[model samples]
Target chain A: MTRPGRDEDPDRLYTVTGGRSRSTTGAETFDLVTLVVSESAPVRGMQSEHAAILRICRFPTAVVELAADLGLPVSVVRILLGDLLAQGKITARHPRRAQTADALPDPDILKQVLVGLRNI
Target chain B: MTSPEISPPPAAGTGRPAAGTAQPVTGTTRPATTGGGTATGTALALLVSVVVASVATLAAVQAGDESARTAIAWGAGAAGAVLCAAVTVAAHARLTNRSLRAALAAGNARAAEREAADNHFADATVPTVVERLRNGGSAETALAEAPPVASEAQRRVLVTLAREVHKGENMRAAAMSACANAAGRVQALATSMAADLREMEHRHADEDVLADLLQLDHRNAQMGRIADSIAVLTGARSGRRWAKPIVMESILRGAMGRIGGYQRVRLHSTSEVAVAGHAAEGVMHLLAELMDNAANFSPPTSEVHVYVEEVAAGVVITVEDGGLVMGEVALRRAEQAVLGEHGDLTALSGTRLGLAVVGRLARKHGLSVSFRPSAHGGTGVLVRIPRELITEARHEERAPAPPPAAGPAPSSPRAPLGAAPGTPPPAAERTRPAADHSRPDTGPPRQAEPVGTAQHDAQGHEQAESGGYATAAPPPQQFGESGLPKRRRGQTLAAVARASATPSRTADSPHGSRSGADGRADDDRAADGRAPAASPKKRPSGARFGDFRRAVQGAGDPEETGQTPLPSASSPTRSSSLSEDDTE
Candidate 1:
């Protein structure tokens, strides 16, 4: 799915990835629901697409969102993120705690945060 | 699994009655184990049914018979209750075993699915890893094998995986083909552009503009060569052709024009043989490659000589150089390069594609090329232009015919065809100095221009009359063999100056003639440029009558007997005695 564009030869893809479809971990470490963040700037000789991915992932972002922003398929994006994660170039975690209703900050704590914000 | 779903709710009804009788046992065991509760409840239900049946039988016997029938009925009820409990327990154990086996099977299926997913990833991931390992100097690492499958479902997954791999292979092949197709299209576009530029070059007339156009034309030819190489690589036939045969001499000149250091190339023994129109470009390419190699390998100061001769089978072109002697291996390589058999891609890749392209063109045209050490101690390449590609050069016949009209005017009845050779030496020698002043190589640059234009017109006429044969420019021949008195050379030089002054008209007819009262007015006009003061009788500049007279005079004089410069210039003599008096 959208591995490369018309001018960029698919053969170049084979050379870039060495014909491997995913990261060294074998399975995708992150999925559409998983959030990812860049750990560092990309290393040299990194592919343009990979560098673009790093630039977009400064903040924690869902895998599906990254794929959408990069104009690549979800599966291909997952593979790229998996490579970065394996290399310690990025980190990923499930945003499961954010889904829990009770984990929201208390009103009194929010009011204090608001006061702190006004002071700043 | 469906059977359990459909019957479990209804079966719970039966469990209720047993639940009451086995209440304590069921309640205690239900929290501990499902198997225990179902077994105990089943037993109690069977016991209730047996007791109810036995009690009814006893009541009926008491009412009908008496105390003896009552004891037998009670004993029968107890035995039936025992049998019912054992059967219930056995059935419950069997149902539990089946449910456990089904659960194990489902677990196994899930594990297999997970393994298959892992295998698919491994199939994609392993090759790159192995390739990396190999690239990293661990060449022994074999490719990762496919993960083993466990069930029919996994086998189906494997089949799908295989199809995907093939689809990827086909996609790569299609991409490669598309790249090749794009290359071919670019080559075609470049070739057409080159042709257009050539047409533009011919239309331009200004000298400086034409020079620039000629340079552009050379670049376009270079581009065409590159396109031809690409086209040949992509399996397309060469696109250049000639409508009519071109002589080997002009072919050599065309090839020479494309190369630098053309001034040092000396062509010798070129025959009046023309190559077939279709094979002209192939011959041009072959000669250019060989000549370029000669120029490059030889010292810059030295010359490269080419000889073209027609043999029994075909035309043989020998290219000789004066340079370092080639080693045995290099000679073999040069030989192989021209024959098109050097299959090593690396050797044939870059600028060295010159000889490889030559080989390709040669093979396409059915020509043979060989290399050997020259007599000059450098490499010599001989290309045999085969009989099929060779034709009779048309310009030779035309060159001699213009001089025929003078033959009848100067001598006997059969003079035009035969005896004009007996009397025309003085006149032929007279025209020699004129041919010299008009020659582009020896004459001043400004004088060369008009002579060139005259030659161009003459060539146009030859092309028209001969149905489009490209002729070589006339080479200057020395007149020493005519044995004319050297004291009269000054007078001949003056006559030459007069004749060369009107180059275009003199070029029209190489032999000027005087034949009045004959209705051949065209011949008279062609001969008008000859000076009336130099000769009382006018003659065509191309007349072979002078050459024929030199031939007869040489036959009559013994000293000059075997000394005709060209065989066509002389005839066999009868007595050879008149030459002795001339020598004295």
Candidate 2:
């Protein structure tokens, strides 16, 4: 593909999918994959296959995991994912689940009551 | 009423008791009063009048029967005597009072004059003293020669005169003392000012020296880079097959080292591939040149993206910066020159040299170069070459094929390239003894001999075309020839000789040498060389232009000696000698 134009925005989100997936209707299921690609964003249209593999492999049962299960070289799978990512055949998730355990603290809870009494 | 002689006067007292009483009263009552003399004189006259009055009274009484007449006579005499006595007393009193008033007035007048003198002295002395001080006279002199007090009018005049004379002396003394004090202050101030000026001068000189030193440092750095690039290229060109890739990598790393981390990251982000070939050295030089331009012109915050992509034809390497966007016209002109437009390459010696180097390198490898606005809004250069050329370059790298050894055999019918187009064969070539001379093998060593001969011929032709070498045409030739072979012997010698001989050529000529020593010679030589060559001949001929172009082209080889000969050749007389040597 030709290099991206200078006018293209670098902040825009892109959807990534495996190249072998021909079904265009499966785009909605991969929405979560698009969210993880937002960090360390590449310049528009210059993203490599490695970035796509990291994005698509976030889901355990994703096409990238399937490719891994089928014994395809992860490098080859990454290149395929980048091509699909550029074609917009898949939709990435809005917010991808965090890979590590949650560490945020819960809110505090307290009760207060007033008793009627005279100065004793 | 008849009395004794002593008692007569007592009776007479009765006769003139009033007059006697008046005399005593006046004398005693007014004795302590002012005009005492007048009072005393009045008292004496009154006493006399009293005595006269008594005598007259007694005489009138003695005349009995003629009492009336006698009384009348006595009365007249007494009255007359009284009148005379009164007039005398009054006159004496008046005279005494007038004398006393005149004496007192005189005393007061003298006192007034003295007071006036004192006042005049007061009014005149201090101001005169001040004036004397003002006029640069000392107080001691003014006081010592204090003006004499004369008449009231003369007093001021004298004080003024004394002040005029003494004031100057006093003022001088005061001023001298003041000036001595002021001189000390002035000396201090002047010393301080001098020190400040010296400090300022030192700082200014320091700044100038620092600027010069920085410029020198920058030039040294540029030379060092050029040297390192040349070393790498020489290593690659020399017969080290494995060392070529390593040298190429080193050159790439060196070029990248010139850039900061941000540029490296940006360069890595773009496509990157390394290609091997004989032109790799040229490519590295071009890369270094381009990177230098980008680093110099681009903002510190910006990144220069370098991409090395392998295409079917050859390798396409591009360096792009998101900084100043050079116009298409400039790019086109640079490209034209790169494509061998045979124009003034000196004009393209600025930033365009980077592109020109790329073009030259591409030409050396039978490649094509194209420049256009990059996808990132900056300039991009694309170099394309045939794969076969790359293979050939690789093969050349594997073997150190000597240039002189690859030519035709010495005994062949083909003429030596060194001979002129239609010239008759040399007597040695035509009538040579075959038995003794087996066509003196023109293989490699013979070919090498002709290289020097070719250069000598070139210089000789240039000299012949330009007439004779001037007296000042040897120094530069000597300098240039020092490190080079004997064929190019008179390079710097001629230049230096010409420069030293013609002292009045131009103010810029002599200074150009020192600057040349400091690396500004490149610019000076280019200008000085081009101006005289085209102007003096009257005709617009590019006679030595080809030689200059060849020299610049050969500059890419790091091991090539006398690569920068423009400074030496710029001297008209020296260049003519160089031209003569070339043509001979």
Candidate 3:
């Protein structure tokens, strides 16, 4: 399997594995082992299998951000994003609302500065 | 109880499919009843028997009932009855079933054909509507002309064509290619209209800008005229008597004021000469014009150097700018054009008249104006005026001494300044005599010589001394001395006295001892009997003196003052002596 280029984003990773089985005519002893793979590692598989993994791993971005970053028309981006969503390679989340308590400035400090400036 | 609705079975003669089968009859199959020759022959025989019986009956009716005729009629009646019954039965079968079925099939075919025709009409109607709309028909008219509902195939074609039209395909190309030719024509018309509208808008905007530019031109011309008037007024106010340095500063200030922030850095270099002369005003104006030109042409951050220098014949004022470095030939052409020596002013300023004014004023003042490439890779304007003009003016400023008398000799006696005379001692000697005379005498003491040689030496000494004084004076004096007749000597002397009263050190000396000595020498020469010939020279050519005095007076007067009177003949001759001294 080929590794991703250096410039590729680190957020997404893919891994793949494969095995072949064989049977002996007569066997006196047998052995079994288990192996684990990490998501960041390159796939130790055939090229076609790696390609299939890449096809599955491809994902879509949000329409607005994609349009702005790519300098494409919003209408065009919307259409492309719709197609990607239909392919089920991406997910989206609604943004959360701001808390009212976080938006206000300190009234006491504001009044103090204004009073000091006026006195000067 | 209901009666049975009897109907004959469909004719076996009609070649249709067996009732339940999916396949219809093939073309090879014939009508079963019509193809049976036995059945057709039997029907024909029955028809003939019936007709023969009817004929026998008619014959019997026409003849009386004889034995043979009666017998024939009875037999014919029996046969006719059988035939008539058979014929009637056959005709009833056809009417009841076969003919009715045939009529129903024909009616079904007709209905199907009408339906197909209606569909075709619907397809054709859409194009007709589109064609009408393309030919400048209204949407409502198009809708009225169109069929109420179009077939699915036709609707698909029109929608696809419209989409192509929207994608910027040429209407004519779409028209010739697609089925909806009329729609394409309508699209072309709409596009043409839109393009025409855009062009009209652009033209209108251009016209508006042109109008605004014309208005701006008018305003600029008015402002230019105002600036010219201000320049003239300032020149009149400063006049020729103003200090050269001060006038130069004022000219620079005027240029800066008129051009505002467009002025570049001040010129720090000092000139070889101060531009001191009667033509100072003219020189200032000329410089101002050049500075104005430089300021107008140069970028605001660039530099303009106004340099003044003395050249072989005169003072040169050069204004250099680090902008458009015009070639020497082009600059000359521009200058000549401005001077109106067949040079086109129109070419220089186009419609604005600044350079022309500068050239006119420069020419009026007798200043030589030309242009050359500057050291800083820019155009340089050089204005040179003769140096004699400035020097002559300074000499005329000193006072004139009394004319020498014809008779006696007094030697080694000092007289109060301006009290005795034959021209005042040279202005330079009188002003700073202590400085000059205080130096140890540099030459060997004079040795007595022949009278002619002695006189020649004295005249030569006087000429050299006068030459220095004349150079120190202003320009008008020099010009007048060169041009005027010699009869104005007394006038010249009086004018000189008035000028000396003004601020020079020459008029302040109390001991006028030098003049008296010179006068005493003139008298001694007369007593020696050689003085008569020298007397005419010593009499102080009144005409020359008068001319010099008048020129001085003219210089003193303002430019607006009326002309002064010319000197009388005796004064002219007297003034001629001063002119001769200057020439020498």
Using TM-score as the measure, the top candidate is: 1
Poorest stretch of ten by lDDT in candidate 1 chain A: A1-10
Look at candidate 1 and tell me the lDDT of residue B163. 49
**TM-score of every prediction relative to native:** 0.34, 0.23, 0.23
* Predicted chain B of candidate 2, TM-score versus the true chain B: 0.26
Please give the lDDT score at residue B556 for candidate 1.
27
True contacts kept of 1: 0.00
- List, residue by residue over B1-584, the lDDT tens digit for candidate 3: 00011111222232123221212321223234323322344345445645676776767656746657767766667666655555544654443345335445755786787687566655676567556555545555555556654456665655554344333334543443442333334333432332233223212213333234323323332243334433332232222233222223333332333333322635432332333434554555556567767766676678877765657887676788878888768787677655775332235443445566676667667777788887866788887766644432222222221111000011000111211112223333332332232112111211222242233223222322222111212222222555542322332443344333322322233322222222222222222221123122211121122222222222233221112111111122223333233223
Question: What DockQ was computed for model 1?
Answer: 0.00
Clashes of 2: 60
Q: Score the docking of each candidate (DockQ).
A: 0.00, 0.01, 0.00
The B-chain TM-score of model 3 reads 0.27
* CAPRI tier for the interface of model 3: incorrect
The lowest-lDDT stretch of 10 consecutive residues in candidate 3 chain B is B404-413
Which regions of candidate 1 are displaced past 4 Å?
A1-120, B1-211, B340-347, B394-401, B404-584
Better of 1 and 3 by lDDT: 1
- Candidate 2 lDDT at B373 equals 79
Q: What is the TM-score of chain B alone in each candidate?
A: 0.39, 0.26, 0.27
- Go through the candidates in order and give the clash count of each: 20, 60, 54
